[model samples]
Target: MGDNNLLSIPPTFLDEVPGLADALADEPLNRVAASFPAASLPWALLAQQARTHGNYVNAYAYARTGYHRGLDALRRHGWKGQGPIPWSHEPNRGFLLSLFELGKAAELIGEADEVDRVHTFLTDSDPSVIDAILADEAAHAPGTETIVIRGIN
Candidate 1:
């Protein structure tokens, strides 16, 4: 029910969580996650952190939570289960990041079907998102002080 055409479903843009940026900058990740459990970004960050530390199961759990939260947001914004959840949109990044992290975690944990499904979902959402995310991570490798959300520095 969005900007759907014959060939494609419309892109979905999630609404921003109020005060999230300030909270992310000022508080710890755990605290932020606890405070805004419905927001995907904090959970995505938690998943990334867990994955970085080699906690695959924890990463999977966190990413799954973020992904579900993102789905709820998408539905609320009129996404009909299939549509472009573009990486170019700042608010969509959390969900895309969660999906990506979930794929990685699924791979590490030997969830072959989950990995394939995630890959397909991501490709369907935005074909360039994977490469874009990889490039962003490469540009902002570990040890950086700033937390990046796609273009957000």
Candidate 2:
């Protein structure tokens, strides 16, 4: 999001570049890119949903695509995806995080219709927010907590 010409990412989230780069380096990810537009639409939708709006459908569609991609990776290269599940999960969380971080880049660019469309979709479809993402916002507490039940020293 930028001056209608240059798209830039926040410094804090620059780590995503490496994840994206990793996808490009891997053959499975390469295959997806080589397919071009035919294979890119659903993903593009995912980006719009997640990166452009806080809406759910776009986000879920985004996440579902990654889930499918992860499925693809498993099928082609035997990559379990647990290694880079975040890249696989970006689209899902993108919807909310993108919205939270970017704050209407479309509207900032005067894309009223785009803004309206995204908001409408969010309101109408009610995209499901995954728990991992919620946990993520909370500093990954869901998976990071220490459950001290019965400790008999």
Candidate 3:
């Protein structure tokens, strides 16, 4: 999000454009190559949308990219565990939530092992922070009925 040109397209911008979110879900891979840090959250949201629509292939592609980039962003931020993820730090929050999106995509794609692995990482991360994270999410969650993109403001 720092310098990525894609950030110019705010996440809410898609919400204003009807069918745009669904369109992204329909063809996530077409833009995968050009997506980076700024686009990671959008990809994650698209992955969630794809998952909801039963588009396993697109879900997997977007989820995989989101998970990888999100994980990298978290690690860079000195987060050593998973738990509920600090979903309040701008793009980091989107990346953290992407873990859940990734897990959902993995399940839809029949990647049971990947889903389990993600679950294990989350469960083993830090239970102490879970409640706070969840409360924060609920309090600041997005209004969209689809994938939950908490703390977008």
Candidate 4:
């Protein structure tokens, strides 16, 4: 849904609507849902875990909601690091692939604004998001930070 359409849907209705995607995400998302804990973790966090372990199924599952659908999240996921992805598992690749999907989806949907958003978010020559990713990546684990990147609207 577009942002306005999303808002148009009543909160109760949105919540009550069953997410068929959740069925696909249930296992791994459940595993890393709580950021090394055992319960109540958000889907975005689990998406991060999916990228970490290269569990593409679960990562794509989780992306249907939350910041995973945001341009900033795409930028973080796909940005090519100055060095290799901090962990052996390469989520950056998935993130990069996901960005391509977003780009194509924007084109198919005629959302040029969204295309710009994803473009500026991911592939810009400027180095801010990349720097932040470098500063924040963890070794042998997925990054769990929800950054507030500025100036990429």
- In terms of TM-score, how similar is model 4 to the real structure? 0.30
Q: Which regions of candidate 1 fall more than 4 Å away from where they truly are? A: 1-6, 143-153
Tell me the whole-model lDDT of each prediction, alpha carbons only: 0.89, 0.38, 0.56, 0.40
Q: What tens-digit string does per-residue lDDT give for candidate 1 at 53-152?
A: 9999999999999999999989899988887888998999999999999999999999999998998888888889999989988877966566565875
TM-score of each: 0.87, 0.27, 0.52, 0.30
Best by TM-score: 1
Preferred candidate (lDDT higher): 1 or 2 = 1
Cα displacement (Å) at residue 139, model 4: 6.3
Go through the candidates in order and give the C-alpha RMSD of each one to the true structure: 7.7, 16.8, 13.2, 16.6
Spell out the clash pairs found in candidate 4.
Answer: 33-41
Q: Tens-digit lDDT track for model 2 on 16-73? A: 2224445545545335444432232234334444644556444444444543543443
- Full candidate order by lDDT, most accurate first: 1, 3, 4, 2
Q: What would the per-residue lDDT of candidate 4 be over residues 11-105, giving only the tens digit for each residue?
A: 11011113423643665545444332211124545555565676655554554343343334334445332222221223333333344344444
Residue 87 displacement (Å), model 3: 3.2
Model 4 regions lying over 4 Å from their true place: 1-41, 68-119, 122-127, 139-153
As a whole number from 0 to 100, the lDDT of residue 90 in candidate 1 is 91
Global Cα lDDT for candidate 1: 0.89
